[model samples]
Target: MDTASRTAIVTGGSRGIGRAVAVRLAAAGQDVAVVYSSNAKEADAAVGEIEAAGARGIALQADVADEDTIAGAFDTVEQRLGPIDVVVNAAGIMALQPIRELDLAQLDRQLRTNVRGTFVTAKEAARRIRPGGAFVAFSTSVTRLHLPAYGAYAATKGAVEALIPILAKEMGDRDVTVNAVAPGPTATELFFEGKSQQVIDRIAGLSPMNRLGTPEDVAELVAFLAGPGRWINGQIVFANGGAA
Candidate 1:
């Protein structure tokens, strides 16, 4: 992939899959800018790990749901890291409950962070990312599986998948690829919250592989799309360990 000197920005890089991707991209030889909405400590830690991976890295703060903030983040990355060749939008929130018991407030929050946040960042990437660049949006395999309580969250991701192809087309022979990664039952803190061991085991068993996925597992896919998987564009690659 020859990503040496290429640059990337990974939102939500403070923790979870985003953290893994930031470090992995650095390992692949791309300068990295780690973006966090808050949590300066974790953000710094992620950047530290990136530097440990032998790439120059910096940490920036931006609310992914805010257009101005996210745009400012892009500008900062460009000014500091060089022109961005890859953008991974991994900042998101998830709260599960049956549709009948859904919390309207949570739904609003999810839509803001998951859907609108992705849109704001993606809009910037579409305009700014260099030709032959890649934009990776995080979705959920639950959207296709249609799990019981994921209605609102799934709807927001469905919107993400819907927008990807259009954005890829908009790039229009520019050699940039816009796509989404739909992960199922990853072992991140966010995914583990509020779930009992019994429930977790059942979900893990749903995968033909008989276990949950790791953040690094998903990051490998993101790194490929970011660097080597240029022809695999305008699609969602599900990294669920054969689950769902």
Candidate 2:
């Protein structure tokens, strides 16, 4: 892939880190395709942001968990934007629950979206992304924090993190770097949902910075991995503010 005309596909680009990544990549000179599952309004707005950054942007709807739909979305993107150089699978869901009180249905949903969705997207990226491209998947810092009520969500992301190294090695011959970004508590709508201010403060205090991460914070790291951080592959990068 030529650096001058690289194109990127970002799943879950309707909001949060994924949206920030799409805008950032666009600002960095990549034509970006925002793959959204629902909410066409938000997806269209994201494309507006991308265009404002002076790059071509398109919105495509596809469930990341469905292989056929996602594969078609990939084909559409390449057909419209030329070959893809970056694939970011940031589409996911979270439902906090203790193991003893786990809801099987919720667990299944998370597994389908977080685990299977990533696999489907990664498979497409492996097949289509050009040489010197990148594939970034999302994990969570909760997998290491081992927090209560995050068992199911963390488990799904753990499975995602497990795919990074092996996939990177497999893509080595193609010169496509594969990695996962594990973000700490972030100040997105998703993170704030169902959480009280007091609880949010305590979680923020866990980081040395004493604040939750912004979508842009994680986006910056992802942009690096997708762009010039090619040497750093097959690893789970923790994008927390010294929250260990």
Candidate 3:
């Protein structure tokens, strides 16, 4: 293996935005490991796409919120691929309900998978990523949109956004950049679930482009940060087509 070859691990990479980012990094000549919570079949498909992109690929199963599990997965990735160059914490869960109507359990699920997951993944990335590498976390435009019924979900990502700059400053000495990508109204399986066409259309129209963001659209920004956008650390970048 070429020691200089970049390697990336993308959580929630079995499908949706995470899958897109993994494939995008592979296309940019980086070996990739797609870490998924479950769904071996989807994970394998993502790896196949990564391989087809002319780069090495593998799939690992691990919970993003579990520190030991993710740490072990990172070890396996380095053993199989190389020292990590990038870690994208694309794994998260969202539940939208008015604050009054929101279930406490739903909020806990979001916090566990979104906040704790990012922290765990980011922790490993901080320690394991090579100098000049990058750590990217996912946020949402809802933080700025302040949409009704998104209180809990938005709050979780807000916490993620708050941590990005602090983590970036902490990693400054190591020459590793840390940032978060805040996508708006992305058209993914998660976004479509429980949303009616009317709701979807209204949200899509919020963008100046009058369309929902595609997973690849957000992946493009992630790919940039993962590779050449080194100066862009410590920011909650909104990739929402002028939305909010």
CA lDDT of each prediction against the hidden true structure? 0.92, 0.94, 0.93
Span of 10 residues, lowest total lDDT, candidate 1: 165-174
Q: Give the TM-score of candidate 1.
A: 0.98
Residues 1-244 of candidate 3: C-alpha lDDT, one tens digit per residue: 2223899999999999999999999999999999999799999999999999999999999999999999999999999998999999999988889999999999999999999999999999999999989999999998998999999999999999999999999999999999999999998999999999999999999988999999999999999998899899899999999886
Q: What TM-score, over all chains together, does every model reach?
A: 0.98, 0.98, 0.97
Residue 208 miss distance in model 2 (angstroms) = 0.8
Model 3: per-residue Cα lDDT at residue 115: 95
Regions more than 4 Å wrong, model 2: 1-3
Spell out the clash pairs found in candidate 2.
Answer: none
Candidate 1 per-residue C-alpha lDDT over 1-244 given as tens digits, one digit per residue, 9 for 90 to 100: 7999899999999999999999999999999999998899999999899999999999999999999988898998999889989999999988888999999999999999999999999989988999878999999999878878889889889989998989988885778988899999899999889889998999999899999999999999999999999889889899998887
Which segments of candidate 1 are over 4 A away from where they belong? none
User: With candidate 2 superimposed using the best TM-score fit, by how many Å does residue 116's alpha carbon deviate from the native?
Assistant: 0.3
Per lDDT, the best of the predicted structures is 2
